[model samples]
Target: MIPSSLRARFTIIAACAITVALVLAGFMLTLIFDGNIRARAVAEVGDDLRTLAANARIGPDGRLVIDGDLSDPRFRTPYGGYYWQAGRDQQIDLKSRSLLDFTIDWRPQPPTGNDVAIYERPAPEGRRMFVLERRVVVSRGGTPTIARIVVGLDQGELDEARTAFIQFAASSLAALGFALVAALWFATSASLAPLRALRAALMEVHLGRKTSVEGRFPDEVKPLVDDLNALLQARNADLVTARARAGDLAHGLKTPLAVLTSTARQLREAGQAEAAADIEGEVQRMSRHVTRELVRARAGVRAFRRSHPTPIAPVAATLTRALSALPSPRPIAFETRIPAEAAAPMDETDLTEVMGNVVDNARKWARGKVLITATEAAGAIHIAVEDDGPGLPGDALSYEIERGRRLDEQVEGSGFGLAIVKDLVEAYGGDLTLTRSPLGGLKVDIVLP
Candidate 1:
């Protein structure tokens, strides 16, 4: 039986795989969003650098200065949160009051060398600064003088915002994973429900309580169920035919045996001992022949029964008991090395008859032992019978097995055993081979579909 927890394992694996993919996708989206936010911040700082450079002036001695307050209300507000510095000839000319009398300590770096550079430095108020710098050439006193503009943005707020976004994304991803696991559990159960129903239906058939399976199965499994049901129907029809044959054979032979018994009794009462003895002897032989024919006929019927799925163990056991009742039974050793529940599409009674006849024949010539064994291979069932008896003559064996031939003409019994085996085996879509046994006797190997 397969484990029930297998569904849970599958669900966990699927959910984990989906969650991992989604989390990676979500992280990539977060990185793209962070990049967009940083791009907008850089653009805003570039605009501020342009406006600050436009307000610069030059003294008569070529000292660069700012002519106005150069302090927008935006600079004083923490919401603006920006720092600016202007330098001419490498000397600070103007700075943001937000720097609070603290000069921006940015190195006068040429912006053309690198598009952007970020660094942490000490601010005017000794606060930590993340500063961005750019160099601008301004026309002062009609001469081009180089002025460097530095812009600083607060790092604490940006760091806090990024951390909050990461926390939110992590929590959302965790929730999505939990939900995915739950959904997977429900989906798996729903998908497998039909298989469970099919299992229960099969179990019912196994118990002999149902003759056919019926259900609305998924498209993938419908064909399997249909084939199984068709096989069951065919088996039931075969069983009906078998029962009819058995009944017909009994009805046909009972009257003749009764007449023979009555005739023998009448001869004895008339004081004709010699005639009575001869009649009785013939009657006994006739009776034996009738019985053997009935057995053979019944075996044919059984072969049809076994064309359905029939377990081998019980059939083998039944044969052993039935064959034990034979008058001249030898030490017939019946060995079955098959699973107790191993089954095939074979009639139990047919299997029994096949084994019984072969074993009985071995017992006739076996010195001490008759062996019967059954096994399965390559989707077929194989039964082999052997004995430690005088083996059949090679030429005689071949001649006897020929169709419609009888070998034991004077053997005071019906010589139809092998013939019947051959017919019945063929009817069941199987083959029977007669060969010399390793035990020094005839070996019969039967292969059945």
Candidate 2:
């Protein structure tokens, strides 16, 4: 099966193209070789024909005579892969013994002013020969007589030569094609090296190891790198503006809330208890909303780079130890069973704060033992903090992040409500699910993505 890869695709295309070209070139070479050899054979046989014409003449009795002899020894040997003949009025007057009992296969043509017709014809024993024939005017002893002359050689020799050349060309072109494909592979790897480096730089930026993508890239990739850097800069500027706005909003609202608190206290001292309580309750609610928005406003891009991998084991162990050390009306045993390698994409401080809330809540309500077990699956971290005390019923469970209501006024808190955990978890794109614990207590399941 062909894999879905660029290099594989390129190599396949190159190999196919090279194979097609080599096949075409091989066929073309064969034709060219065959044509060239045939032409050469015709030219060579023409020399023999000219020799036969020059050595012939008509005697005074009107008979053909020969004087000169061919230099090729094959003419003297019987069926020696070469043959020749001379004739007059389509009758044989002289012939080479190499023809044996079988004459050169030919058809006579009428005289046409030194024109020669060369062609291939079959000989004895399934052999083929190229024959060159023409009618020449022979004059000797002051008398002229027209005689037909023919010369030919075996076509098998030209075929053999063509076959040899094709074999050699096929092998040579195969090697050339292989070398070209190999070279193309190396070139492709070299060309894509820049992309791999750019990807690494991008990974570093994504992991928060670098503020922006930086590298010496090729011209084709440099523009993309520049665009990424520009985008990073723009996003950084926007985050700075947002964080500043969040800070300003927090600072601006504190004065009014503080004044309201002061006004509530003044009302209480002046004997207006109901009014004071209402104003204080409103102030507290406003404070919670402001805190939630402040965290949210600083949230958008701030978490992008700060959410480094925080190992759950160490944080969970630390929280369990601290919560266990705190004083409780009844002794509560804290259990921690987190794997060492378990980690989440969260800042250390954020994980500590988030886990601290859940663990402390469990310790506060846990009657005998509190269990904290964390596991990871499906690209998320699941941390469940369970207490063995009386768990909240279905209706009493925390179904909302904020309602300005209290947690049944049964247990005290660190003032950082579950709403804060939910807001923070959601900001980092995690979850907070509250349910009944298996140990007759509440279970807080947090899934951080």
Candidate 3:
């Protein structure tokens, strides 16, 4: 597909319009010049014919004769592309030597008082001739005899002149079109510089390098930049307020839950053992819910808005040590195959929260061994957590990773670990998938950009 960028579209449209305009202008110019040259040729031939008619006389033998010299020398050269002829009573009388036996072949028509008639006629060697013809009356002894006089000039020179004009015009117009396209390209790039700057600012905002759009812009784009900055400011302020409220709510509930625990202890001491157990279970469930909400609050809008490069290897190593220290009935081996240079593109706190939950869950389910490995490729980080326990069935893989979905409720878990990891990964333009592991257990693969 052709990229739908503004520059490409504008260049195509402007180039088409300019090419069409130049072609039409060149065609019209050539046409007008050809017409004017043809008109001038007819007028010159008419003038020469008038001069020839004025020099004619009726000789005593009733034949036509010329009085004196016609100024043009081509009248004497045979086939010189110029000629003259005269006739009386449909019989040829006098003619120019240049005709060389090639007849003008013009039919004379009587003209109004001083008007001349001109037409194109055939001449020698297949050349075209512009002929001017007229009928004249000569008187002898007060009696008049009508005679026809004609003059012609070859049209080859005019055709050559028109061809040369067309060639020159075509070259000039092509040069002009090229220059116009070049100027348009330069002007278009310069005009869109502000937009390019705006795009760069947006990229920086996405990468958490800048808080808002910044820099000078044209009047046309300044308002847009202002609106985007306003949106970012509002978003950041709202996230801060929401997180503060969540923190306050969690602290408030913690105090009440602690008092409840103290009361349950007193009941157990007073011999109401069953009631104390039930109360403690309810309180623990409530506490877990509160902790889940706190995690959600931490993974707030700012989780994605404020990004910082966090090294994955160090965080994974720290998590490995913490998980290994936990007491388990079976000795569990923890393996960390992460490079020191591996980094994820997200805030450090968010990455810690997300990876912690995932690694802890793997430790809980793995029977003999758990593996945490991370690698960097293409502009993204890939982290996988695998375990050697009974993996989930293929039929349950799609929905089992969702929140509050535990295959066995007998297991002590709220089932929010994978869900939280998925949510946090997507928030930072990443994805998480669950699949069967080579270690005969579940594999959690995450890609963070």
RMSD (Å) per prediction: 11.6, 5.5, 4.2
Winner of 1 and 3 under lDDT:
3
396-421, model 3: which lDDT tens digit per residue? Answer: 78776555354334356525556556
Location of the lowest summed lDDT over 10 successive residues in candidate 2: 399-408
lDDT of 2 at 287: 84
Score candidate 2 by TM-score against the native.
0.71
Model 3 misses residue 241 by how many Å? 1.9
Sorting all predicted structures by lDDT, with the top scorer first, yields 3, 2, 1
Stretches off by above 4 angstroms in model 3 are 1-3, 43-61, 65-85, 88-108, 120-130, 134-148, 151-168, 259-282, 328-341, 366-371, 375-379, 401-416
Query: Cα deviation of 101 in candidate 1 (Å)?
Result: 6.4
TM-score of each: 0.48, 0.71, 0.80
lDDT of 1: 0.70
User: How far off is residue 161 in model 1, in Å?
Assistant: 1.1
**Model 3 lDDT, residue 11, Cα:** 82
Model 3, position 256: C-alpha lDDT score: 91
Residues forming the 10-long window of minimal summed lDDT in candidate 1: 406-415
Candidate 1 lDDT by residue in tens digits, 1-449 = 43458687788679769888878978897898688767776777766765666676667767667566544565775434567777865678777776666676756455674255656667444456577776666675577877777887766546667788888888888888888888888899998888889989976665444667877899998999999889988877876776687678777878887887788789899898788889888877676566556665565555433435677777767766776666664455555566775675556666665566666666676777777777789978787888788887888777766653432342335334676666667767788888898889878898877
lDDT of 2 at 49: 86
